[model samples]
Target: MGIPLSPRPARVIDLETMRQRQQARKRLIRLAPELDGLEMVYHLPSESDAYYGMPLLAWGLREDGEVVGLVPWMERLTPCQSLEDPEHGHFIGYRDPETEELFEDPPDHKVTELEQAAAYFEYEATEEPTLIQQLPETQGTHALCMDDSGEPWQLKQVFGWRLYSDGAVEALLADERLIDSTPILPGDACLYPGHSRHRVVYFFQRQIANRIRREDPATLEALALMVMPADQEG
Candidate 1:
């Protein structure tokens, strides 16, 4: 069965908020058993790289039903409403697990007062909205990724995944056609929609930055502004 992506309301609070987040993440790890074999991508920026614009946290699942991630820091995975919230980082479009396509809004669903009260433990139940409701609307954004030759490929969506918690929404995207032709390694660039100006983001890696710095210091210097740090609370 496909795992549900929506956060479950916690009515009982036996643990602290930090522990709750950790336990929630751990529960997700258990749910996604397929995630065990897949590579765990990281973003460890070096001293030469600029700190600005680097991603502080990110999480996502692959179309094949495995979790794929790139993380550099884990500190910023604090519970928040939406992954699109500026506090999290640039919003990589959320992929619908069933249809495997990008989407703008959360799934249509409503929470009843009893459900909210039974699920919420952090605070008194005040008609808490579903976790997916916190996501930003992206109807206008066009999701695209760059290939080795700098060509853009549109991403397809997979639906059925639902948001269960506040912080663990998946917005990272991947394309099989693009990956087959040219694997996206660290330093590869992709367009990040939603920003007013042209914003290019790269999965930051220390070794890749070193290599780029050797071949073209100027390019690396400029790309420093667009590095997306792989950050996870896990």
Candidate 2:
């Protein structure tokens, strides 16, 4: 008697999977107008109210009428009262999808500015070539640091790459490695460069990192992975 071999798994076609994705995309396309209308109803502040203290993330309208952004410190699920509205005035809230009725003050609404802005662009159907712009990179004002540990750190001061008269490019980064939950780089007893060749690699804002963690925590895991374990080093 011969032992029976397990049957091979059937080969699968990816067409159905691809079709589902296409259907999802089409659904977003259908909702494009509704998303665009939300912009008119909810107002994002044009400038920071607190000069020294600004939200980690904010959306601003460009001169040509495009909304550009920064990562928000936290996803604001509650509908923020429009900037034009008085602080004590009635705040507009979310609408019931099934009932098509607006709620005056909804508890636990799950919408954020990042989601709303991203969806607006995703829904738009465009055939024209995309116009792109670059935001200026400033060391302390506009950057964050990430070390080998995969935690997001805020920049203190960037002693970035130097292009010297001899044409050699040398760079050094100080790690503020997510200790004590403070995002800013520390003043003393911190990890400096040359300890690990690529220890401090990513320059991202903590708000953006938090958004990624919220949306897909796996992203942080990926960023944290090393090619080889530190213990394996000779």
Candidate 3:
């Protein structure tokens, strides 16, 4: 007799899997809120803080809702002395999800004077107080660099983006790519751009630095911002 062929594995869709997926979708929809009438502000995390020192974008939610803030990951330039020749100056930028305050040690690890000047020039050319007021009550602030001892430093400045929202803060946390060890809570701030429903949160992590090196050393730095469940605070 001919040997019987093994039965092919059945294509299956489990109820639990279906339910979980549906719940996730519903959560996302529930997170979006009407943010047209609330005042919003964006500020870079303080350099003195133990985390979030890289160029980050944070949004403060002023409207009454479950979602209070949103933040997104971003990269910035850092000035450095050429490894081959200390006298000759070269610059590089990194994306770090951890707090910028963490770099307060080994002052040599920080950005260069040229990078600092560039950041200032960019800020001055872009900031508009009147246009900011016209937005549905929106505000923003520049990023501050800190010294080795976690004290505020004036040399390397930073900036961030901001937005207001009516949805649940959990919605912003949906992106697995943005989630890091840093704890994101309901009270944390978030930034959402106009005409976009998904908002991003900025954070600092050492892995982000590694990512910068891997992505682009000369021009661009790509980093991941992760979101963790509120119950499992980092």
Best by lDDT: 2
Q: Candidate 1, overall lDDT? A: 0.31
How many angstroms is residue 231 displaced in model 1 relative to the true structure, after the best TM-score fit? 18
* Candidate 2 Cα errors over 4 Å, as ranges: 1-159, 172-216, 226-234
lDDT to native, each model: 0.31, 0.32, 0.26
Estimate the overall C-alpha local distance difference test score of candidate 3: 0.26
Q: Which residue segments of model 3 deviate by more than 4 Å?
A: 1-13, 16-22, 30-50, 53-68, 74-234
What is the per-residue lDDT of model 1 for residues 131-164, given as tens digits with 9 covering 90 to 100? Answer: 3322221211122223333334222221112233
- Return the TM-score for each candidate structure: 0.22, 0.21, 0.18
Against the true structure, what is every candidate's RMSD?
19.3, 18.3, 21.9
How would you encode candidate 3's per-residue C-alpha lDDT over 35-90 as one tens digit per residue?
22221122223332222122222222221211221222221111111112222211
Task: Please give the distance, in angstroms, between residue 211's alpha carbon in candidate 3 and its true position after superposition.
Answer: 16
Candidate 1 structure, TM-score to reference: 0.22
